[model samples]
Target: MQIIELNQLTKTYGGARGITDLSFTVEHGEIFGFIGPNGAGKSTTIRTMLGLIYPTSGSAKIFGKDCIAHGPEIKMEIGYLPSEVFYYDNMRVKDLLHYSASFYKKDCSKRIKELAEIMELDLSKKMDDLSLGNKKKVGIVQGLLHKPKLIILDEPTSGLDPLMQQRFFELLEEENRKGATILFSSHILSEVQRLCNRVAIIKEGRLMALEKISALKENTYKKFKLETLTKVDASSFAIPGVTEWTADERTISFLFKGNINDVMKKIAEMELINIWVEEPDLEEIFMHYYVKEDGSRHEHVSA
Candidate 1:
């Protein structure tokens, strides 16, 4: 089932861009990664889908219903953790969570206690006395207390330590096993690579790439570094499917996207001191979309 849908969804602030012709769908029981840096419309797209803001053009849908038309009903099944969490300074964590649970029309007391213990959150502390990380923990607990079916997380790990981040990922995985769909939006490529089944790369509020994580890593750019016995000719590595080529005396490096054997055959003829061929990580592959063949970044319209 399609859990979420955005068809030519666009939003703009006066003359500025929010997202342009953005389109994608989140499937049932899958972890979908919405990848982009700051001001890339990740938040705007999410907000539109959740009916926080009306779209300037196009439409968004959730659970097979128009988002704005049925927002109240749709939101009941959603668990959302915003990039930044804010709460009344005087409120205790326990009270805040209980208040959040009241909206779901179900008793979430037992679930809240379980989640608080798992998150190692101190419920007695007031919101004003907590650190940024603890505040984020409260957001996590508040979102999950009602056992929502669709979890939307925007940059969820910003304030967490590595250990806490690991625990949070494990918790998410457990929720997935019990049949929850996740839409994880973040600029952290490594986190997306580790946790998402597929990712939709967004830049300047438009879709860049959408593919399975395994296929994206397998078929994308390969980083090749070669050290020759003598000064290397630039033309020697100027084969097709190579971009961002650079050379310094005996060293030559570039990102190759074609057959590995073509490069291996070229390497067999070269007198080399050392060589290293590696798969480009998620960050490198993501940046490749914004890079021109001439090794310059494409100018983006800031949102």
Candidate 2:
């Protein structure tokens, strides 16, 4: 039931880096999160998958078919919403949607109307007349109008307000329940944390980590900040689980991943004015991955 498969999926732009030896898969009915900062090759990998761009090396398959050789067949089941949407400005929303639907055999008018209503998109408005948010709504409607089997969303919530985003997430969840496989690409950690069952983290055009959300959180790192009455030697806190710390006069903070008892005992020996120990959020963990120069932390997943 692997709907999508990537094997040594490398893409390079001349001498610049794109994705290097990337490999992963999206199984049926799974909400797979593809995460990384901008320029981390999220878009590159996606474009290649969609066959909009050819890879310098490696290959991708969708629905068990080669993406390049059988792109048109594979694309019939995919609904893709890019971060930035572009359309014929002269066409009304209704006209453009109808045009897009023409590519498929079945009638998408009724589904288009339903999606527009759910997204609150004004079908009467010309593409040029809509705001960025409204245009994004149009993109959502167009992408889902055909009731595609696989949804590929790249930074799909960019221009939406909080309420709209909530609604959109609900819509995607509904689609998932209806047996649609989704590949959600975004830099927003919280959104990925909330919706994705499994995530593939990429950095500098390389896969960094791939794990279930539960596993990632279970291995959660703790953030600690302490204000001491006096300065202490940095090496004093160099325990097995403690990462490097940032020190400023009497204040210091670092991330810890193991036995809290050991850290508590060490802190008990210190003269502190105040201290704060809390669970690090995904953003903090994301920064941890970003700063890692070595790829040793990546957990390679087989396709």
Candidate 3:
């Protein structure tokens, strides 16, 4: 079932700095990614969906109910972690978790303990005394303790160390197994690539692309670098799908599209010492979507 849906969602600010014509959906038990650079409309869209901000035009729905008219009902099942963490300074980790748990009807103590162990968080520490990363752990614990049906996380792993970030992914996987729907927004492409099966890319308040990660990888170009035994000019090989080429004596590096067989065959006819092909990572794919000179959005395909 589609847990969340946006229909031509447009939320323009006084200076035209918000999302425009945004449309997407989050299905039940699916991990969805809302990806964009800083100043993109990602946060605006999220706030609009949460009914924290009203859209200038269009509609957002959660569980078949209008978000604006039914925010309280929708919020009951959502676990939201905003980009910034805020809490009472004097509150201890345990007290804060307990306070948050009070808003829900379910018993959350067992989940809280489990999250703390996984995150390696010290529940006895005062909020004011903890470092930024530790405080984020507290936020993570609070968000997951209630076992919300829908988890909406914005830059959720910002302050986490590498190990803690890995653990957080594990926790998300566990939550997914339990049938939670996730809408995770982040500028970090790698994290999104790792956790999200489908992603929507937004830029400058506009939706750039929406597709499955596997599809994006399949459709995108690949990079190739070669060191030939003899010097060869690779500029003639540049084509529409290919991009930037750098050549130094007998070594060349460039990007290409379509079948590698023809390109490799052509290169094989030349004197070649060694060659390597590198797949574009998520970051590279993301840059291609959001950083184009024309500022146009591409419709990404699902993997």
What candidate 2 gets wrong by more than 4 Å, as runs, is 221-303
Estimated TM-score per prediction?
0.81, 0.82, 0.82
**How many clashing residue pairs appear in each of the predictions shown?**
0, 0, 4
Tens digit of per-residue lDDT, candidate 1, span 209-301? 777888655657888999998887777666787877888988988888878898788889899899998766545766775567898665432
How does each model score on lDDT?
Answer: 0.87, 0.89, 0.83
Q: Assess the local accuracy of residue 152 in candidate 3 as a C-alpha lDDT between 0 and 100.
A: 92
Better of 1 and 3 by lDDT: 1
**Candidate 2 lDDT tens digits, 138-213:** 9999889889999999999999999999999999999999999999999887788789999998888888788898
How well does candidate 3 match the true structure in TM-score terms? Answer: 0.82
- Tens digit per residue, CA lDDT, model 3, 82-117: 888988999889999998999998789998999999
Q: In candidate 2, how many Å is residue 163 off?
A: 0.8
Cα RMSD of all models vs. native, in order, equals 4.9, 4.0, 3.9
Least accurate 10 contiguous residues by lDDT in model 2: 294-303
